[model samples]
Every structure is written in structure tokens, then in C-alpha cells.
Target: MIDLDKVAHDYGGGALLSDITLRLEPGSFHFLTGPSGAGKTTFLKLCYAELVPTAGTVRLFGRDLREMRRDDVANTRRRIGVVHQDCQFLDHLTIAENVALPLAVSDRDPGAQADNLSELLDWVGLSAQARARPPELSGGERQRAALARAVMMDPEIVLADEPTGNVDWEMSLRLLQLLVELNRMGKSIVIATHDLNLIRAAKAQIAARVLRIKDRHLQLAGADL
Candidate 1:
């Protein structure tokens, strides 16, 4: 569903990523692991078309990112869901409202989707907190809510950055199970996390390719994983 061909990215300084070629096939799962400042987040941005590569090309669904118009980019983004490291949410909105924002923005009728929304909240184990505001949620609740928001649009690919970063081990595993369930339903998944143990746990449930970015390059992870 996404392809990056020898893609390299740079800011005003030097390159953050180099020769990072990858293809995320349909219904596949991948874990992106690397040290801090190793460009794991940057790679996710490239995959989701948030940042254009300075050198090579990033193609989403066979279309080159650099060639897409502003509106085109926005439309393409509808097919990809991103759970950021910070998990930004509208504090003014309730957890259910925040999770349903994507459908609302897509011009979907909220009344028609109310039942699905409730089921989704229940799926993430946040049914009781649906009416609660984001600030009232625990760290794990926020993360699960974020995941709910990301996948509400039924996106073909889901990109999560440090999904287990803030939660305890138990919560992390719970979130991981939710993701694995999504993958089983045929959504391509790419999660950028430093927690190798989480990746190991996920492997027990589904087939996932472990990838690492080191020395400015993206490569298949070694057996250490």
C-alpha cells in the first residue's frame, strides 16, 4: 500500500534518513525500531506523506507524493491513519467526540455512525469514559483513544509512533492486542516503537517484519529482536 524507493530526507541541516527503501504490502504488519534521533518518526512521516523526501520518492498507492497537489495530499491522507507520539487531541472534546472527529471531518453523518462509534469505544475498552474529556483520561486510555480515532475512518494503513511509550506493560500489551486484531482484519500496520519486548509479544500472535533504522539506513532487524 506504501512504497519508499531509496528515499532520503533532510531538514536545513544534514540528512536524517538515507537509502530507506521499503514496501508495506496489504495486510502486513511491521515494527520500526531505532534509538532516539535515529529518524524512526521521520520515516513514519515520509510514509504518511507528512514530509516529502529530499532525494528519492515516496509513493502511496502508486502515486508519487511530490507530484500530489495539496488537496490530493489531503485526500490520500484519509487512507492512512497516524497515531503520533504526543497523541494530540482536542481537549475541549470528549473522548468519544475526539475519536469520532475523523468521520465527522470526512463529511460522514455522525447520526448514522453513532452505533459504530459506540462499538469502537467498547472495543478499545473505553466505553465508560466515552463522555469524559481527554484530560480526564489515563495515559493508556489516551493511547487507546488515539488508536480508536486513527482507525475510525477504516484506513488501509495505520502508523503509530511509540504506541507503548507512556503506558505500563499491561496496557501496552492490551494496545498491542488491539493492533493485532486490526491487522487480522486486513489493515496494513506499521508501528514505530523502541520496545523490543512488545514487538516480540506481537510476533507470537501475528506475522510481523521487524525493521530498524541505524547508521542513517533502514534495514531488517537482526535476530536480537
Candidate 2:
């Protein structure tokens, strides 16, 4: 659903991603792996139109990103869900309210989706902590709550950065299973992480392609993954 053609991004000083041509197809699952500061996060940002490439074209849903206006970009983002590395959330809001923030920010009436929010919390195993605030929840709870929030609007694509970085193996697999289930239901997924074991666990359950960013280039990871 997203296409990058010879995409290269420069952060003023130099290019972070060079000659990166990739396509995220419908109903496909991908794992992005790289060392720290290797531009894994940058690649995810490019996918969701958060950062426009400096040297190439990025197309979302067959439309060129460069042609999209401010409102166009905002609307396009609604179709894509993002789970940030920090799990950005309003500290004042409870877990349920935080999960419903997507719907609230969209033009929709948040109250109308109360049932959906509850179901999502249950699905993510955060039902008990719905009344808890972001600061009060554990790392795993926060991450799962973040996932629930990301998908609250029923986005077509889910882009997650270091989603399991702060959690244990059991929680990591739980989150992975949630993503896998979304893929099974036809939502395209791209997860940027350094977790090799998590990638292997996901591979055992589904055919997931692993992409590694090394030497400022994106390539298919070796069989070791």
C-alpha cells in the first residue's frame, strides 16, 4: 500500500537512507531491524509520510506524497496507525481515554465508540487497567494501551517503532500476536525494532519478511533471522 522509489533521506548533514527502494504490499507483514542510530525509525517515518524523502518519491495508496496538501497528509495519517517508541500519551488521560484519542481527534464523536474502545482494551488485555492513567500503568500495559489506541480508528496500515522494546518476552509475544491477527485480517504491518528473537517468534507463526538497515542501505535480512 506504500511505495518508496530510490528513496534517500538527508538530515542536513548527510543522507541517512540511500538508494532505498521498497514496497509494502497489501496483507503483508514486515520486520525492520538495525543497530542503534541505523535509521530504522527514519525508514518508518518515511513510510507513513511523517518525513518526505530528499531524493526520491513516496506514494501512499497510489498517490504521490509530494502532491498531498497539509489536510491531505493529516487525513492520510488517519488511514495509518502509528505506535511510537515512547508510546506518546496524555498523562492526564486514563488508559481508556488515551485509547480513544484517535477517534476524538478525528471528526468522529468519541462517545459513539465507547463500546469499541472497551472491546479493544479487552483484546489487548488492558481491560483491568482502563481506569488507570498512563503513568500508573506498567511498561507492557502502556505498550498494549498504545497499540489499542493506534488501531482505534481501524487504520489500514499499522506502523510501529520499537513496540516491544520495554517489555518482557511474554508481553512481547502477546503484542506480536495482536499484530499477526491484524495482518490475518488484511491490515498491512511494518514494525521497526532491534528484537531478533521477537522477529523469529513472529516468523514461526507467519511468513514475515525481515529487512535490515546496514551501511545506510535497506536489504533483505539473511536466513539467520
Candidate 3:
């Protein structure tokens, strides 16, 4: 669903990613692994249109990234769910409202999203705290809320960056379960994390392929660990 051709990205004229070419097929699962400062975030932003490549073409669905206007990029984002390590939320909004914001931002009425929101909250084990504000919820709850918000749009692709960073092991597994369920339902999943244990845990439940980023390069990681 995503195609990158000879993509090279620079920050302040310094290269972050070079000669990056890859294609992500529908319903596939991938994990991006790399050390700190290895350009994983840059790569993810390119995938989600948060940043345009400095020297190559990025095609989403079928259109070239350069051809997409800002509104087009915003619209394209609706089809791709993103869960970040730092789950941004309105401090005053309740968990339910935070999860529903994606629909609100898209101006898509979110018909029956209330019901879907409840279901997702329950799936993520956050139903009991639905009315709580972001600051009141634990780190894990906030992260799950972010996942709920991302998928609330019924996106075709789910991209998570360090999604399990701040949570305990139990909470991490719970969050992973939701992602696994989405993958089972045909959402293409790509997560960037440095946690090998979480990767191994996911491997036990789904056939997820691990891709490591090293020296500004991407390669398939060996499951031999």
C-alpha cells in the first residue's frame, strides 16, 4: 500500500535516510528496530506523510507524495492510524472524548462511534476509566487511549512508534493484544520499538516480521535471538 523509491531524507542538509526503497503490502505486519538516533522516527514520518523525502518519491496508495497538497496529506492520514510513545491528549477531555477526537478532527460525524469507542475501550481494558482525564489516567491507560483514537478512523494501516515504552509488562501485553486483534482484522501494522522482549512476545502470537534500522539502512532482522 506504500511505495518508497530511492528515498533520501535530510535534516538541515544532513542526511537522515538515504537510498531507502520499500513497499508495504496490505495486511502485513512489520517491526522497525534500531538504536537511539538511528532514524527510525524519520522513516516512520515518511511513511505517514509527516515529512516529505528530500530527494526521492514516496507514493501512498498510488499517488506521489509530492503531488499531495496539505489537505490531501491530512485526508490521507485518516486512512492510516498512528500510535506514538507520547500519546497526546487534551488535559481536560475525558478518555472517551480523547479517543473520539480523530473522528471529530476528520469532521466525519463518527456515526455510532460512541459504541465503537466503548468497545475499543473495553478491548483495551480502559472502559472503567472512560470519563477520566488524560492527566488522571496511568501511563498505560493513556497509551491505550491513543491506540483507540488512532483506530477509531477504521484506518487501513496502523503505525506505532515505541508504543509500549512507558508501560509495565502487563500493560504492554494488553496494548499488544489490541494491535494483534487489528492485524487479524486485516489492518497492516508497523511498529518501531527497541524492546526485544516485546518483539518476542508478539512473535509468539502473530507471524510478525522484524526489520532493523542500522546505519540509516533497513534490513530484515533475524529471529534467531
Candidate 4:
């Protein structure tokens, strides 16, 4: 569902990524690991068409990103869900409103959304926090809220950047469990993180392939994961 072919990104004279190639299929979960400036985030952005590669190609859902018009990319994005490290949200909006924004933007039936919205909140253990504003939630609550928003569209692909970065071990495990459940339902999942402990934990829950960027190329991560 996601393919990156010989992709490279350059800013001015500096190279952020090079000779990277990857493919993520349906029902597969992947963990992407690398050092601080090793381009893990850049790679994830490439997968979702957030940033165009300075070179090579990114093919998502059979369409070449390079040839896709900007509006086309935006439309295609409806089928993809991304959870960021910062968990962007409107400070004034309630948690439920933020989570339902994706569906609203897609012009889905509001009445039809009622049930799914409730179920999603329950799934993330956020039903009680639905009417609360984004700023009122804790770090873990906000992270799960972000996850719920990402999947609100029932997207075919889910990309999370450092999903458990600001949370404790218990919350991290809770977040991982949510991702695992989504994968079981056939959503393609890619989590870009530098946390080896999280990767180790994930290995025990699902058959996820770990890929890393090193020496300017993408490679299968060591079994140490």
C-alpha cells in the first residue's frame, strides 16, 4: 500500500535521506528506527505525501506522488491517517470534535458518524473525556486522542511518529495494543520511533518487520530489536 523507491531528500546542500526504498503491504505492521537526524521522520512524511522527495519516487496506492497534483494529494490523504509526536489539536475544541474532524472534512454523514465516534472514543478509553477540551487532557490522553483522530476515517494506512514518546510504560503499552488491534483489522501500520524498548515490546505482540536507516540506505534492522 506504501512504496518508496530509491528516495532521497536534500535541503540546500545537506542530504536528509538517501537511496531509501521500502514497501508496506496490507495487514503488515512496521517499526522504523534510526538516530536523531537519520531521516526517520522524513521517511514517514514521504510515505504519506507530506513532503516530496528531492529525488527518486514515492508510490502510494498505485499513484506516483511526483505526478499527483496538490489537490489530488490532499484527496488521497483522506485514506491515510498520521499520528504525530506533537499531536496537533485545536485548544478550544473538545476531544470528540477533534477526533471527528477527519470525517467532517470528508463530508461523511454526521448521523452515521455518531455511532463510530462513540465506539472509537470507547476503544481509546476516551469516552469520558469526549466533552473535554484538548488542553485538559494529559500527555497519554492526548496521544490516544491523536490516534483516534487518525483512524477516524478508517484509513487504509496509518503512520505514527514516535507514538509513545511522551508517555509512561503503561501508556506506551496501551498505545501499542491499539495499533496491534488496528493491524489485526487489516490496516497497514508504520511507526517511526527511536525507542528500542518499544520496538522490543512490539516484537512480542505482532509479526512486525523493523527497518532502519543507516549509512545512507534503508535496511532490515538487526535481530536485537
Tens-place lDDT digits, model 1, residues 82-175: 9987789999999999999888888678788788899999999999999999999999999999999999888999999998899999999999
lDDT of 1 at 15: 92
Worst 10 residues of 2 by lDDT: 105-114
Off by over 4 Å in 3: none
lDDT, candidate 3, 60-135, per-residue tens? 9898999999999999999999997888788888999999888888776678566888888887778999999999
Record all residue pairs in model 1 with backbone atoms less than 3 Å apart, i.e. clashing.
none
Query: Considering only N, C-alpha and C atoms within 3 Å, which residue pairs clash in candidate 2?
Result: none
Q: Per-candidate TM vs. native? A: 0.97, 0.97, 0.95, 0.97
Q: After superposition, which runs of candidate 4 have C-alpha atoms over 4 Å from their true positions?
A: none
Q: Is candidate 2 or candidate 3 better by lDDT?
A: 2
Superposition error at 213 for model 2 (Å) = 0.7
Ranking by TM-score: 1, 4, 2, 3
Off by over 4 Å in 1: none
State in Å the error of residue 115, model 1.
Answer: 1.6
- Candidate 2 off by > 4 Å: none
The digit string of per-residue lDDT tens for model 2 on 1-225 reads 899999999899899999999999989999999999999999989888889999899999888999999888988888999999899999999999999988988898877887999999999999999999999998988999999998999999999999999999999999999999999999999999999999999999999999999999999999988
- Per-model clash counts, in order, read 0, 0, 0, 0
The residue-by-residue lDDT of candidate 4 on 170-218, one tens digit each, is 9999999999999999999999999899989889989999999886688
